[model samples]
Target: MQELTTLKLIERISTLLRAEQRKKYSALGLQPVHIQTLDYLASCNRFSDTPAAVTDYLGLTKGTVSQTLQVLERKGYLEKQQDAADKRSVHLKILAPGQKLLKSITPFDVFIKAEQAIANKQFDSITAALYEALVALQNVNGTSSFGQCKNCITFSEENDHYYCLLMQQPLDQADIEKICREFISVTNSGLV
Candidate 1:
């Protein structure tokens, strides 16, 4: 019963954190989805140097990823080039403008603002407790064949954290193995 209650609280906190990111990212001309795509592209060292590597890492539906790539390309945030080794394939590379933008934007600012709503240093305690609960849950979920964030379609680096744009949640290694449909890998590279 105690564990159940803690899980419930974590769920609620997750929802609130998501809503906060939505509101903040929206203002930057990005929805969580856009951030996810960008985040994935930036994470892999290869993709960091060759943007087109994003498609391979993400395993996205070709058409959907292509469309998203076009949007980013058109926006001048990414550059596309034909692969030298495989002329039939294209490579996407993050441009100077894109890096500049990502460096300037982060949803953590919202987290800090929300933290102010609590009193007496309670926020830290709550956050720490929640993390502990999540770790406990992970132990139960982690014994599977796959880790969530590592294998997820939407897991991506965002502002120093692994974010899932589809579920609007952070990706945990354990959660990915559960094959949860709500989560996907995300990116934080297009923010600034």
Candidate 2:
């Protein structure tokens, strides 16, 4: 019998994950795209929360993002606030309802079995390997990694204060944990 390629195994896993998410979304009367948008909003930093950023990250058209955002706003899941520093730019902030909904919908039920079955050491190793592979793919594709601020090339920690040279701003704990659209790989930046 022929062995399965690594790509096939990865695709199968992704398929199952999406199938499970679809089931959940169906039951909750939600579209996968809407839930996905909400999820991204929940995990993304301020720098990545605008409609333009969402469109870029989701690889969707501006009109599509605009329409979906309108639906989400009508559903009271999020709010659009004009940027204080930039009037032309708007920010999307997930409200309490969206946060609560995401909490209930997430934890990705499809991974429960695998997550429970994996040994801690093996899990860590696999996670690290997958992340490395993802980074390589993103590099080849010329796409932003959308990684945590702490992992970005411009991130700097000085005397317990976190700062981003690219943004010219200080980062709080939340900002450091949230994904940033401007993220650049530390190694790729030739700084490490």
Candidate 3:
């Protein structure tokens, strides 16, 4: 038998994970894209809470994202609000029901068991390796990084205050942890 290449292993793992997700989604009468949009909204910062960002992150068409958003909104999973600054733009906000649904559907047992099995250092190493692989793939595809605001080159901390130079806005602790679509890699800002 041939040895599995890195890409093959990753693809197999992804397929298994998606299969698990599909089961949970089907039980709740939700599609994979619906769950993905909810998950993204839950993690993304204010700057990345728009349909355009969702479309970019999911690599889906505007029409598809629009329909998904409409369904989620109609189902009381999310709300679409006109941006205060940009009246023409809208922001997607996951509601409490969406949060509850996400919590119920999240696959935590596998991750919990994996964490319990791996040493802290080993887990950290694995995380770093996976992040590197994701970066490589994103670079190849010219896709948005959607990295944590705290990890971006534009992030700064001073006197207990967090700020994003790129956005020219102050960030709270929660905001700092949320993912940003405009994330500039701290290690590869020049390349970005």
Q: Candidates' TM-scores? A: 0.50, 0.59, 0.58
Cα lDDT of model 2 by residue, 24-77, tens digit? 888977778899899999889989999989999899999999989998899899
Tens-place lDDT digits, model 3, residues 6-70: 56546644654576667778888888999999999999999999999999999999999999999
What's the distance in Å from true for residue 61, model 3? Answer: 1.0
lDDT string, candidate 1, 54-74, tens digits: 556666676767787777888
Off by over 4 Å in 3: 114-192
Q: In angstroms, how far off is 4's CA in candidate 1?
A: 3.8
TM-score of 2: 0.59
TM-score of 1: 0.50
Our model 2 lands, by Cα RMSD against the true structure, at: 19.2
The candidate with the higher TM-score, 1 or 2, is 2
Best by lDDT: 3
lDDT of 3 at 169: 98
Cα error of candidate 1 at position 140, Å: 30
Per-model clash counts, in order, read 14, 0, 0
Error (Å) of candidate 1 at residue 146 is 32
